[model samples]
Target chain A: MISARRAILVSARTLQRTKPLRFADPKKIRLREPIVPTHKNFDVSPDHPLWAFFRDGNKTETVLRSKDDLSTDSRPWDMPELRLKSFDDLHRLWYLNALERNRISTEAEVAKEIYNGDVSLFTKLDDNHLMTQKRIKQTLLERQVAYERAQLSSPEEYLQLFEDKYINADESAIAEYNEKLVRLQYAIFGIEPDLSEYNLEEDINVKFVEGLSYVAKLKLGRYLASNPGALELPLNGVMEELPFLVRDPEVAVEEVRAMREEGVSRKLDNIEVFAFLRNAIEAVRSEPEELAEEEN
Target chain B: MKSTSFKCTCIISQHSPGHVLACTSCSRICSLIQFHLFQIDSHLKFPNTNEINQNLKHTIPFYLTAEQSFSWLIQSTLSKCHVTSLLLFFSKLQTSLRPISITSTMSFKTAAKRGQFDLDRYVGNLRVKTYKEFAKHSRLPTIPAPIPTLRKDERLIGEAPIVAGDLAYIVSGKHKGKISRVLLYTRDNDTVLLNEVTKNVVIPKQYWAANQTSHVLEYPVPIPRKFVRLAAKEKDEKGNVSYVVAEDLVFKEKYYDDRLKRWVPRRFVKHHENIEIPWPSPMSEPKDDQYSTLTEDVYNKTHELQTVAKSPFPKSVLNELRNPYSKFKKRELTEGQARRLNAPQMPLSVEQKIYLAKKAQTPVKKLEPLSEEAKDLIGSRMAEHLAKIKNPLLLKHLEAVSQKTTPEFQRVLNEIEGKQD
Candidate 1:
């Protein structure tokens, strides 16, 4: 009676003994089954034989008609439903097919006979093959024209254009543009934009939004007002209780002023700020009656 | 008196026969008669007999006969005649026989009397008077003049005057060779302090870079030369002895065991020993010549190797044998043994376990499920594949044939999906 471990070892030894001594030729092998079904409903019997024949015949006729017509039609044959997807996906598929064909033939044959020498024809066929592709290119061109017109019309846009063109046009341009956008957003809102405002991932954005909302609640402000000597404590305590609120000087100053008006002016000392914030937050969180009693 | 001065004639015979006398008198008989008359006259003249006899009463009498008396009377008349002459004779004889006394008792007695006299009081009074006279003359008592006080700058004058040695302290340099004995004040320039005890030590003011005086080197005794040699020997002997002694007592006196008493040795001791060989013969070699005799020799050389050879089992066999007690050392497993060990056990998810069990039971060939559609599609493609495979021109077409049928291709796809999962 052999154990499982002994059996496995015996099998391994048998496999080693029976294995082939020479490597097999990969090119000589052939598959009896289909490689990958293109569609979930793929069948052996041709459902559109007449359409396939017309397409094949048209491709040949187009080749004889004009080199440009053949090249235009040489793009990957898209399924009718594929036109509804993004232009980028259609273009990716087209390039993938072209690469596959090129692997079978030389690049020269594909470029000369398939893509045709005319760049316009290639572009037109790709645009016609996918309606989304034509729409995207038109929108891009229109956006460029409109941007140019806007740059010419306003001094600010003109300045931005000048900076992009002469000052930081090459590698730093996008970074500079993003910095300016953030600055403009900060100026308009008087606060940094929350991560969710940019439609970031739910977990990350939610955490960021929650953190920002915690900052905006002025929980630290209320704590500072309630605790008279908390601001005099070390930064560690103040930072731990209300990490987000302590970072902003305006919020801190406003909170200090609120505490002062409430006759708890002594809490404004920087060292005691955390203790004050904690007390203020506690006061704000307590029941209304308790808070009123504390106020008194 | 000149009426008749009788010349005394006398036959005067002196005792000493060496004298002869010629008297200036009358003729011989007359001279004789004169001598007799002088004697009688001299006798009468010597003083009245009765009166002389009366005066000599305290003296002893001298008796003479009538003849001798008549002769005396005649001699007396002659003596009277030449008294000066007789007198001269008597004087000469007296001068010649006179006795001289050398010692004078009167002078010694006079000196004694003088010594016995009371002169001390007079002498003492004279001394007082002399002293008074001196005092009166000088107007002061005679005392040794107070050692004339020396001025601050004045040096006492005398032959080989005793000048104090320099008073000095080591100020700035090493040793500064501080000395108090100012040996020589040469040329009134510099003073040298002789460290006589130290010998060859002559320190000058320049040495100390200061001028000081009033110190003296007292109790200066030279160091004995023998002391230096004794010190050096002591140090050398002590050093060697110290090295041989215990570390803590290296600098202290040490004692060694003697016959009857503990005594420190003056020199180092050396010891030697003779080694004895127990086994003298070389070892015997093995019969097999392929092996070196040295290995066999070593095996026979040691008692350990001999003991090892006496054991029943070979060394390798002994090592390979498992200990019988090890079976009792097996650990018993507790419930939830995997949690205690922190080892991952077989996954317990029902679906995962079932799938794994199924995989374990299925045959490799039947692992992939066959769909009806896939089957139908494959059936149709089989004809095409067969046609393509037979045609030589279809070699190119065969190249397009996908590798779906190969187990390796399916395995690669499955691996990719597995990684993604």
Candidate 2:
């Protein structure tokens, strides 16, 4: 019913346009099921346009295969398996199932007339076939819901919401991050940086992350998100899916942007260096301890 | 995508407090559910849980990039993207010219992935659920737990000390130093069901069958963490592998496992040279006997793996959903990351060819009717860009962009003019 409505809606709109359907009705009317294959309801002609559908490659002996045999021939993709499939995969599978269903039902009717017996075996295969369609649709619905819930206009827009390397931050933010990172590396190695020029992309982004284990990269991304004025990707939206970047409760952006405007950027002439800031935080952290000791 | 179909009466200041978002639910459902195979509970827009925090707002405003800023041409998120709408719906807010409490949590600064909180309550809920399942599945002559629940202080936090498939050494009791596979673990009570450790249960008369003699059956017994220590295979300095008591098997502080993209509690074994033993990736269970799926294929995660489709859903969708997030929810085959994780095959089959033919024959889906908010956004954005152009003819496009320019456009224009002055 859903497919029919969607087809008709598309067909109605297509009628307005100049291009006609390639193999459908002359007026491009898409029938939900194949009507051209059937003959006055009961008998189907051998050479009908959709003859390939009614007969399963024109096989006859296998039509009466036992209930057990029929059940094994076709089965629905369950939730777990269906969930693994991509949208396009399911879209293809839906068509396959629809085509197979049409064939099986036609065969089932033919088998009843020829053998003068029940052809419920086709129904078994059809049931499983229908189940797969049901699950496929269910899976697609879930994806649509998830996409809507994420509130993404496009996937590109969502990349900004995460702190992924894919998200392109301004050169200023990256360069600023690079300076701090270079300082940290130098601090760790007990060496002094040139203090003048450093290319951010080369100074330890792609190469450094590529060398470090993935765990190290995550920790680094965490560090980037935690530090202010470092790498400011718009940390907006529901990050329920990608829990990679650890977010701070608040960011001191107004101050940082104000500083950026004041020309205290990458070179860090007036800004507090990593070591100095660490010392300041430590000093602030110890003040409460000292006061508590005094009270005691 | 057309954002909203019809002009909501809210445009007329219909609601109280002068600020209410139009029923985005109606518009969203219309587009989201493309199939009518199952009935969608329109009310079930957001998955509400008592422990889960719905408030995803940040404390500070953050600016999105110019490319990302172009999204208001279509849509914004709900609870998840609740904070994301700062820019997307800013035009709408300007038109309404109202301060909404719902948007108050729009703190864009912290991308707080703080998904679930109130851990204690959350844990309690999980335990209660597990207990119910255990009770339901328990058969006749069920063994009663000697100790029921642990005190809040005693209860283990983070990941349980023992999990299924872990080889645990019985430190004390009748089975002292006996190594066994831990089949199950109850976190609230430091109890583990060891495959080797079992208690003989006397068959009750109610459980006995006709002409059955009274006898005992052994069931895997739950051992306290105090009685069990994790055992691991360790190579001596001589380079021969042998089992040893995994010394100092303490959970290292929670770190995000980048491969898994979750804060997994990793256990460090001191005896094994402090090598981290990540939680064993749960083996994928074979599909039900009735599913007609190959047992090996299910175990190998090869079911329908070849039916690879270039996802219409974004790459970020894969990143977010993590290659079908539902599959990973059970941690099934985390180690299969390198096992053809990215399926490369999409040979257009006959069915697919037909699908494409039908798809082409079908008319393009109608664009959603642009909401008043969308017009406001495009107008405001265009105004900002057009303000720099001193051409008189091109300036008319700005006026024609929106029927009524949003207040934000006015502010942007004022800022531009002020800068010029």
Candidate 3:
């Protein structure tokens, strides 16, 4: 029912943007449009585009599986092979996968509650979804590489390659590359490259950590959250999801600017920290003698 | 009565003062009639008059006159014997104006046995409740959602979910009696990865052959810490001493054994008892929630703001790059670094490539490792050069030119010279 309403809302928005269809006879027009039952109602008019959906016939199946019922073949739809020809196609596919992943996770949480905290059903669902997403990303990365390679033969190859190397690489890679690049320039001028002041290995490690696989990144994030002083990543948001790796500082600057527009106006007053502090003080005051004696 | 002086028969008094006798030693002045009455009631033999006088002389309060002492003695004796006088004195004891304080003899008993001062009473009122508990109970009480509570024995086995690196006893399998260490904790998959520490058993036809194998079970139960007892070291015939773990030892702490329906050693508790090993206090629990611990202030401050997305290049990388030789010298360089260094030097440009093609290149000298001081000097000069070049393109060009080794450069020079000849 919710999906039907959403579909209707989307169609309604599209209808609003364009002209209304003119009927030959005014009497033929109906007052109310037929409602689409998105969640459960599979039976629909044969002429409808979704008629193929009812081809399998009515069968009871939940949108999300419970933890115990999770299996490899539990996904609602199989991800198609990646033969993305263009950037737009890749982008669209990425968006679609992200959308599905979000929906599955959200519905899985609700399903967990409905099943009374038994999340075994969602276990296989997440595994399958993550695998599919990984495949999609691998396809997208291939497409991006191919596109960049194709661009190299173009008239602006130098400029394109320059952007590819500096902008496309992650921030830490760019920094390391930049330092090395500078040293190279000095060498070209017959001057020695200065690198002794910097710890190149540490820099590379930080960059390597930044470039860790998504699963590794999540694991690292969890580890850092539990134990903050784990591997020190370059970014302050070590616990957050991967940030855009663009060479253009202006892009990052603009993003920061946009974020600041929606940022909090007031400083957070941590009542809990203060509350803890106050409690500690009161405890000390109440049992100063005993505490002192214990210390002695 | 005055003519015939009644002899004082009071034990406390030696002589009588007229018809109303004042016993100087007794600290009581009483009528001769009262003194005569006391002598008749008290059956205990009295000391001689002289001995009584000596004791009374020391016992009497200085503030009391001989008459008062004689009267006090008569009153004390009467209160003990006469019901009317005793009732009067008891009534006075109830009032605030009573001459004496009646203290109960309860100080001799231990506090635990003392009825009013039981330790349990105060301690019972002193709860271990925290603010969270106070808040939980203070709210409007609602019917809690009922959850199925498993019995101890039923709960003992896989009651508490097993984690990685836990120890377990295989209750049902090809290796039924084997003790194993948990490897992978896949709660979703009813099977866990385990390495058997005990003697090896033949692989069942249905299972794969290996010392370590993933076994499917009805959720393998974790061996409770209480069941794991420290065993004494034993010497084998070969004179090798080894520590053996004793699982049969009764747990010192009494635990309710559901199957037995009685308090028993914790080891006797059901194999499925859902007992969790008490974890040491976590420095901080991993919290994805915004309201976690001392950092809540920072979390709240950023709550409205989107969390900074992770950056591929963090400033820490730059800091590392700034001091590559220090801190992590033992660590291997990342593959990315090796790739970047080996990347075919970016072509300087179409023009530079053409220009290099026309020139007769000079042979470079054999490379030598720089001394520490020389490296420092070179590093300082490079820092100055880096500071001056803001153009990324120029830096790329440098990277391209610096890719070749001395041998590679020498070959290139030889090729150019051969072309010139």
Candidate 4:
């Protein structure tokens, strides 16, 4: 047993000689995993603070490829893909992220959407990113309103209503409730929910029929039947089916007159007759007086 | 009265023709002639009187020619006229040839009395002629009145008025005594220059004449001779007051005795006493400002109060004593000492020393003894090297090398030259 113990001691000595002495305590050895040798390997360890940002293999590859392309022997600290665990190192990483985010045209808007969804996450970012996020939210809201206006048939009406309704609202309230929703839908989702998809000219024929409510269709049909001369055949009938034209008094009167000789029964509502007279008088009044005296 | 007896004696001697009876009338006439001749000689003794006498003799002989013995008189007169004219001419010539008179009223007798007889009639005639000539040619108008003489009390017109000495008073300065006689005139006739009568002296135009009632003593009083003499003697003994003279006072007697073996003067010994002198005071004595407290106390107690206990010697003696002590102390080491201290350790190691010594002793490079051709080549090459090198040391080293192996170098140089050719 003494010989066995001596043999064990000799084996332990050989092991100590064979292996490198662990000068660093186990708790102090923070970076236990060795870095991968591949140029594309930009993976942050799970224990690292920046792991969540570059977790995806594709994202890691992209960041590593960019880092490799920008690598230099003199400036290891400047490498944006390098993930360090310290707060100061993380702060540098966030700064680099902010710098890259600003370089992208759409990053501001994307960052705003991210911030609005998770404000605590945005606040965790450096101050520069927080400021950029606010600026981006403002820009996105403006762009969303512009896009919404672009989709509108009558942007003036919507703009007037929007100004009247939201101008009086608190800035935070408008941004949080009204502008946020609109901006999300328009800018982020690229969707205009309030606008119709129908083309004015081509969809005129089916606008009254297709996707119409039963009550609406019945009302429209009965009105058309009683006032048969209100619509001309073929093209006129398509025109009469237009959503805006059907409600227009001058168009109904003209359609009635054009259809009268075709033996179509039609009776004009008193409101329609009054509208027709008012339109005729407005037309006479709106005409240029002697061609506006030639504006010389 | 005895002439008759003499005549009888003369008759007895008549036979000799010199004894004719002498008549009284003849005696009387002869005597009268002798008397007249003596009177004329006496009168001629006066200057210019001899000329007059000679003229009278000539005229008397001419006047006697009209008497009974006229022929005899004529002969005598003619003979005397020659002598008379000769004498009168000499006298007139002498008078005319005189030197100019210095002043009027100088008489010929006075000139004779002065032993100026040669100039006697000359001077007299000159004075008379000058006075006559001056009187005739003078611009001053003559008056019938006699010439007036200036008296002591007389004053000239327009002359400055002189007050009586007793009437004037002294105005300023001591001895401003009353003005007396006018002393000397400095300005024109109008101003009196100095008044001797006023012992203090008044310059006439510069100082106003003093009134009688004016104070006589306004000047500074004269200082006594004793005070001045004492001050001068003191100044001479001490020299002009100076710090060096004052510093010599301490141990002056001892220094004098040591240097000259004699006692110095008390003034020389006490010269420094007057300088910052501490006078013995009944009250508290003032402290000396020159020296530090220790020095002052030592100096005062030692030199000033010899009776006090613990008396120190003078500074000079103290310095003399301290000098030998300082000399006995160890001499200071100079900067070279530090360098020498480090010199032994300068060589890096034994190996370095052996290497350095061997390197120093070894010949750096060697060359085979050259043939004449090789020497000539090297000589030309060295000349070229020397010509190219402007450094004096390099040139000197090359020259030395050339001197060391001249024959081989010459052979090498010749070879070089042959190759070049």
Candidate 5:
């Protein structure tokens, strides 16, 4: 009456007579729970063939490592923070991210090979890392859109991206453009004169940090606010203290410009703010030629 | 007469006997041999035309006068051995053209680097850029990006072929006639990665390079889609899998589910129309172990669909939701704050509104007229335009018609039609 599948299954085992259950029942412990076998622990040493898979950032840690061990200092950058970061920083981050991704994937692949359907932690780790990768791109994309807008609003920034078109522009039109430019400068950067003429003591050596749009300058200001370390310079006070809302940016922009125009540039006693500002300005203004230098 | 023979380091174009242009981007950095055009009046040669006389020499510094693009022929001879020469024929792009007096402007070459000028630098630059891009692309991580097999390639998922998991037979290359799984498809290159036909590549260990450096990483090399064929994996009653050549498999755009919420691209055999070839699904979907996020919540579907599409752009995209782990980020807003700021309302307060309404009720009725001198100038320009009407009948009609417009409108007309090209 048995099916062929059952017959085949039965044929593989040795025939036996019915015996009394010594351990009460086969799988059941009537009165007490059964003892569980202890799991042996092992580490993937640097000597292992697939050790590269275990890398997190600087150190090679196992994917099974507890979440608490993850670097607390480092964080996935927000769009605003990313705006303040340099292209080189982003590019390097992207490259670093690819390595991180590869490491995670390699670990997942190896783990799957050893025990499939149990590398859920690696997958979770990957999901966590995936956001950071996406954020990098989001930051870049925001910059690209801003760059395009900046290109349209002002022909001055990366229109040197290809070739300089405004060099031979009509004198009268340029005069008119500069008049318009000064008004926009007042609105956006809070500089009274054109950014080129705004007599900040420090040389704005990199391309055009003074002319960064409201978004860029605001992030720089926010970055200064979230003081990793304070500013290097002796500031009059923090010129960018008030929190600027991205939705209504004009209010904050006007306030900064208004304060400066009234001869009251807020002084700040912060460390790396100016230093970070200088570095950020340099990063934002990086050209392809400058990128070549940065990559080296 | 030119005293010096400018035996340049650059290789002149074979098609056109002109200066060998440097890779315009790297030209500044790379210390290549130079050719000063003004230093030695290099004879501009076209493909078939003979060397021209003095008039053509005068035309050397010629400005492109017409609005239409004139193709400037230059040849890009790279230093690479056995490399086919890229003939650079760049049409004057409108974006590059500076709007100014042609007479007043200097020759474009004079303004550029003292090195050789090539208007066609853009064309050659693209190929070089593609090469550089490929170089970066080749150095990707050891692990392949997890692309779902039968999943329709959306903007979020990126571009993927309909027959993603099906067996692909190589039609060309060293792995010709070899059957392999179509591991990946890149829309940018229109190439497909074959799982079996792999190549050993050394991925750098860091951002500089990373992965399997000890034992060079084995990457599934992607070939152009043209050299691959979809061979559907079919099994007989015995359950032995055999790949059947599916040359006439037609891709049909159809709804995957009864709800019609999702559209999956599917293929069916042309010969046996009923035999639908479903793309082989990946072993498991890369889902989070945590909460399940609906597609509507994940994506901003408002752009693609006309309907509200389930509350487009979730709070995360709007910068109102903060990352759980981030302590440095200060982007999130409270529920009330988000609602208040995002609301569509006028900026003016009640006091300002009342003041504005009061001002509107009692408007300044006084109006000023243009001074006599200003009136004369405006009238004169309008008359001058009126004089240009050659036909006596039309001139009379225009003169009478001009009286209908204000002096400001006449000034605007003069401004529009006044500029001489």
Candidate 6:
């Protein structure tokens, strides 16, 4: 009644039991095999060696060291002369602060959940730890600011620094953009635009195209046919049809320039491979003398 | 034994040699055979007699005798020696062995101190010898040599009058805020020994430095005679709070003493003989006695007599300006008093509304011809307006009415009748 695979397995097991493979120096020889690498890639990615220290899943259940010994202190250590610390020192402090912040937030969440969200319990349970962590974070931030200020050589540099640190899209503008994106998604999928209690996966249904315009509906239908099981519309084609949803030309141009500078190759649409090769060859041949000099 | 089986290490040609291990087919000789033999010889012992005898049986030719075969075997075994010479010749053939072609390896000479001095040859006993040990000393002076003190007359070398008690302000240098009294004067280097005059304590001889330019100068301000307030306050309507100076409520009058090239009180002259300047006002006033003395009475009488010739200042200003001590004392107003004087005002009474009404009625009075010049201006303006009337509708109506009433209408009718006839 046994299959060939089962028979082979049984015979192999019997053979192994009858005569085990013996090493010349069994005591000296390592019993364990060489460690199998967790990562297959050498370059930067989720599977890279750089991410080896991180957990496999989003839920971080790994608690290092003694959690019971944690205690609260009213006064936190103050580093008023943090600005005097070297770049390496500041970098270390910043990393430590970040680690502490992550630990505190996780701990606080766990504690809150355990106590049924009774926040007053936090006072008894290492509350000062969070406060001290924040203080340390602030100290590190101040040190960074001071260091940056010291490094700045001119008003232009200061302006650039300020832009790098503080400048971002306005909150209201981001909210409006998000709303517009949601609306576009609704229109494309032919779902009723209800932001009050919306869940993208559950709410989006291709069958409900009654609210969508003819062109949008057609685009959605084609996209669905081409890319089955996709929840969102194909952005490029959809954006062309919806002019208002398209990003600013200047911003798009800036993004393109940034990408080009970062060495991202542009997709050569409608051009033959041979023509592309020829153009690349011509460009390489006609490269500027400074680049040639740099090579030398 | 496997002489015929020898293969060339070259991958392209698998040539077997006829006698010597040279590839006739490929027209090439592999020098690797010599290296192979050498490697085998170095790793294992050199092939002994038995191995040689065995090789001879297989490899020797049939025409050769035993001696000849033995010699041939020996030659074959030592064929490497001849091959090496051949290799050397071939290598020489490929590359010219000329002096110019032969290159020597480049080497560098490092710069370093390589010699050591022979101390024994130079001198013996390098250690220094001293009989007196500093640590073994029994007595040590607690203080260094006594400081030399300069004579008073020896210090008075300047033409300008210098006194010991003269106070000087540090006009410049790091010790700027310091005010000191001259303890001793030295005119040789224009230096002075000074004692710092701090509150209730005189730190004697704190410095004895030369009086460089702008270092120390006479405190060039006289003691003020009377205090005066700088800012004036206007009286409020209630009259309960009178006007007072807001800033520097009590200020003293300071004067410069040109002769001493310093500032001092009027009492400074009292120290000098043959000077008859009397101390004035509060300087001579008895501290506890509020009653005016005979000298005060005389001073007041003279002041009053002098005022009779000229208009006197108001009593309020005179009283307030007289005493600086009292003025300073009065600056500390109670919280209630301060609030009453400076708190936000209540809305003005109806009796105070006359000004607002007058302000509102400004246009009425403003438009009125209050003066003869104004009336004349209005009259001229009216005449100018009347003169500017051209092509009026009323004039056109009047002209039409006159035309209807005129004889021209009848003439025109008669002319029409004549034409018909």
Every prediction: chain A TM-score: 0.20, 0.35, 0.25, 0.19, 0.32, 0.24
DockQ for the candidates, in order: 0.00, 0.01, 0.01, 0.00, 0.01, 0.00
DockQ of 1: 0.00
Off by over 4 Å in 1: A1-42, A45-183, A186-296, B1-421
TM-score for each candidate, following the candidate numbering: 0.13, 0.25, 0.19, 0.12, 0.24, 0.15
Say which docking band candidate 1 falls in: incorrect
Better of 2 and 3 by TM-score: 2
User: Please, what are the lDDT tens digits per residue for candidate 1 over residues B145-182?
Assistant: 11111222333232211122322222223334343333
Better of 3 and 4 by TM-score: 3
- Give Cα distance to truth, residue B341, candidate 3, Å: 31
Those runs of model 4 whose alpha carbons end farther than 4 Å from true positions after fitting are A1-52, A55-126, A140-296, B1-421
Arrange candidates by lDDT, highest first: which order? 2, 5, 3, 6, 1, 4
Q: For model 4 chain A, where is the 10-residue window of minimal lDDT?
A: A71-80
Model 4, position B6: C-alpha lDDT score: 18
- Estimate, for each residue in B226-252, the C-alpha lDDT of model 6 and write its tens digit: 111112123567876533222212212
Superior candidate under TM-score, 2 versus 4: 2
Give the per-residue lDDT of model 6 (tens digit) for A1-296: 45423433344433343333332442453323222211111112333332222222222223222233443322333354343444344445556545544443333333433444333433343344344455545654553344345434333443334333222435456456446434544433334343333333433223222222233433334334545654333323221222111233234334434555676534444333334433433443456665978899
Q: Write one digit per residue (lDDT tens) for candidate 5, span B1-421.
A: 2111111222121222221211122221112322211111122122211222222233322112221111111111111110111111111122333332121233222322234332234344564454455455443555443222221232224324434566888878788889888776666456687779887766554533333345466777667777887777778999999777655666577655433223566677778777777767653344433323344433422122111112222334334333455655547876777798896776999999999999999967653456799999999998898777789989778769857988777666565666433
Q: What is the lDDT, from 0 to 100, of the residue B153 in candidate 3?
A: 36
Q: Could you list the iRMS of every candidate? A: 96.3, 27.8, 48.0, 87.8, 37.3, 42.9
Error of 6 at A105 (Å): 3.0
Q: Which 10 successive residues of model 5 chain A have the least lDDT summed?
A: A35-44
Q: Give the proportion of true interface contacts each model preserves, from 0 to 1.
A: 0.00, 0.01, 0.00, 0.00, 0.00, 0.00
Deviation (Å) of A59 in candidate 4: 7.9
Candidate 3's displacement at residue B29, Å, is 99
Candidate 6, TM-score of its B chain:
0.13
| Candidate 2 clashes between residue pairs 3 or more apart in a chain or in different chains | A151-B77, B2-B368, B57-B105, B58-B107
